[model samples]
Target: MGCVSRRTQCAPRDTRFPRSQLLQELARYTWPGNVRELRNIVERLLLLTGDAIDAATVRQVLPGRRPSTSGEAGSGTLANRVATFERDVVLQELAAHGHRVTETARALGLERSHLYKKCQQLGIDLKTERTQP
Candidate 1:
């Protein structure tokens, strides 16, 4: 049921992003719908943006949500912090490789299947992600 199984051709390889800044901006948003909403937003951004998706674009697309503060209550919970870090790492790597599973796996020193499972666990939709370019 994932995006990978449905696409006929490979995704384009020219996508570019201001990786760290964008990731920081995204981390600041408190996603009300959690992973699904995040995935949808990522898909939309990839589809709509011309060359890169910046903090300004993200701010324009998702207004009204406040950026998270490090001092906020419960922000230090170990489980939450770990999960957030894991998601960020996976997403950054995926973006770095243009969401190509094989390339990403090689970069991460993981098997393609293991990377896919990891992405699923991290709530990333590889299919939608791979279509970015």
Candidate 2:
């Protein structure tokens, strides 16, 4: 893909990229260059695609990677998808902070109690998490 500048010919249109599929595709990528590279690829995908951004568009933007399965997009409702994403992020942060609730909450920009509430809502058993080897 070419450099994604302001003049990238991307007219304002409603691009329907399903978050569940998009997130799955993004998570599957190795992203050797890290967050910056991921951001650039996303920008390119948005600027290059017409109307909608699907698995094919993602594959074109990110060659060599296997396209996500069709069923991934229909896995759940938008609220469920968002909850899954949030839960995954919370778990990752908790792991990074060695299961310290306070530290995980701080890193996630949430109050400690709020983090506990979030974990409860997400059905994450924090008691078990703390005891994991």
Candidate 3:
């Protein structure tokens, strides 16, 4: 067997698709479901698309999703904005993994303890806060 990086192992194998361009478009998306969402999209594309998976196909499949922009709707310092984004990502990941710290951390490529520290810094009370659907 050939050695494959974790990211490459996770992607679907479809030779007909413009893999690089598809990857670029996927990189632009803010996957709310994180790795799970990425896996689902790749699987869907493999099963649904024909000759090539283009940017238009990706957009059509992922409705209402837009590329992440630096200028969000808020008046805050750069640090504050970064923190807010981090907090949101953590919350979403936690919810996606049913608030399982280890799973969330692994999915995010972070250590479990580091994830806890980040959650604390973001004022996310995992014990008290319910996961959003």
Candidate 4:
């Protein structure tokens, strides 16, 4: 399962703020589909916002409030971080192949063997999903 390509904008982070501070901006983050998706968001934010950007600015642009799988209402944990990454990868692949495994592997520049390996590592089950028409 993949996405139809679309363009959207996201907010910037404050450089004067510490990394920990940005982490506090959890309320500001949108769960973008993939690493590329998230990177694009961060890049847009870095380019558009100045040194003092904060959470309020982020909330304005990001769709839906950031969900708190964080357990502590903003405390991002190691498990949560891993899950986010896995979700993104699955979404990215789903988008690329029009939701077809053979197509998705090619789109990702991966061989069938490697793709299967990745699916195993990422815990994605292609069989459960309906293929693209």
Candidate 5:
């Protein structure tokens, strides 16, 4: 998050794009085109938006698309937003590695113990997730 702020500091003056909201919108989007298309969209966003770029700006930049409101971003306190993002990322990594705690921890650059603690904190039922199809 700090890194995102640092990078966006170099953006056009007064640009107020929040990284979590932006990331939420991006993740919800289904890119029909490839990396080049993503680059173009980002460039377009930078060029088109004024002082602040929030969810509405993102919607305008990507026409005909309505981002889901079910996402955990853009409607909470900062800590809740961060927790939601962390939970999603950890869940994804765990699923990707077939719920192997050590593998998931290594993939996320976390110690196995830390991952377990995180899962516990996030209320992620590993046994339940693992048992699911």
Candidate 6:
């Protein structure tokens, strides 16, 4: 019932918030902000709390979806287009490698650790193409 400023209170705390209350707060929020904003918020929270976050973290960090690149004069922005292309490529390579991270990294000419981080950043599900036994 106090001031519900997500910028301040939702900045992450050692104290855990109740799941129900957090869900309600998230529903009431109008977070038109995109994935970038969510990423920044999550990063800040991670640094602040030094702990793992869960679904309830959604309340503390707003839900965001990147805007679509539709009906633009060209491809919205060069940087965004490049990122999309790169993500697609990584996903393809991952699929081709049967979701084998080490093999995918080698094929992409990347270090395994670097590929892991890149896949995380691109929001690619690393287990998407698991090989059959």
lDDT of each: 0.64, 0.68, 0.66, 0.52, 0.69, 0.57
Tens digit of per-residue lDDT, candidate 1, span 24-56 = 776788777756666666665565454456776
Which regions of candidate 3 deviate over 4 angstroms? 1-72, 130-133
Relative to the true structure, candidate 3 reaches a TM of 0.48
Show where candidate 4 strays beyond 4 Å.
1-80, 131-133
Pairs of colliding residues, candidate 1: none
Candidate 3 local Cα displacement, residue 56, angstroms: 16
lDDT of 3 by residue, 1-133 (tens): 1211343455556435565677777777776775667766666665444334567657645635623434655567889878976776687667767899998887667899999899899999888765444
- Tell me the lDDT of model 3 at 130: 59
C-alpha RMSD for every candidate: 14.8, 12.3, 11.3, 13.2, 12.6, 14.2
Query: How does model 5 score by TM-score?
Result: 0.49
Sorted by lDDT (best first), the order is 5, 2, 3, 1, 6, 4
Could you tell me the lDDT of residue 129 within candidate 6?
Answer: 41
Q: After TM-score superposition, what is the CA distance of residue 97 in candidate 2 from its true location, in Å?
A: 0.3
lDDT of 6 by residue, 1-133 (tens): 2223444365546545454554464456665776555456545544433333344444434533223334553465788767775786686566656778888787677899999899888777666546332
Instruction: lDDT for model 1, please.
Output: 0.64
User: For model 3, what is the error of residue 80's alpha carbon versus the real structure, in angstroms, after optimal superposition?
Assistant: 0.5
lDDT of 5: 0.69
What digit string (tens of lDDT, one per residue) describes model 2 on residues 59-126?
A: 64674563333347547878986787577668767876899999888767789999999999999999
State the displacement of the C-alpha of residue 82, model 1, in Å, after optimal TM-score superposition. 1.3
Off by over 4 Å in 6: 1-73, 128-133
Sliding window of 10 residues with minimal summed lDDT for model 3: 1-10
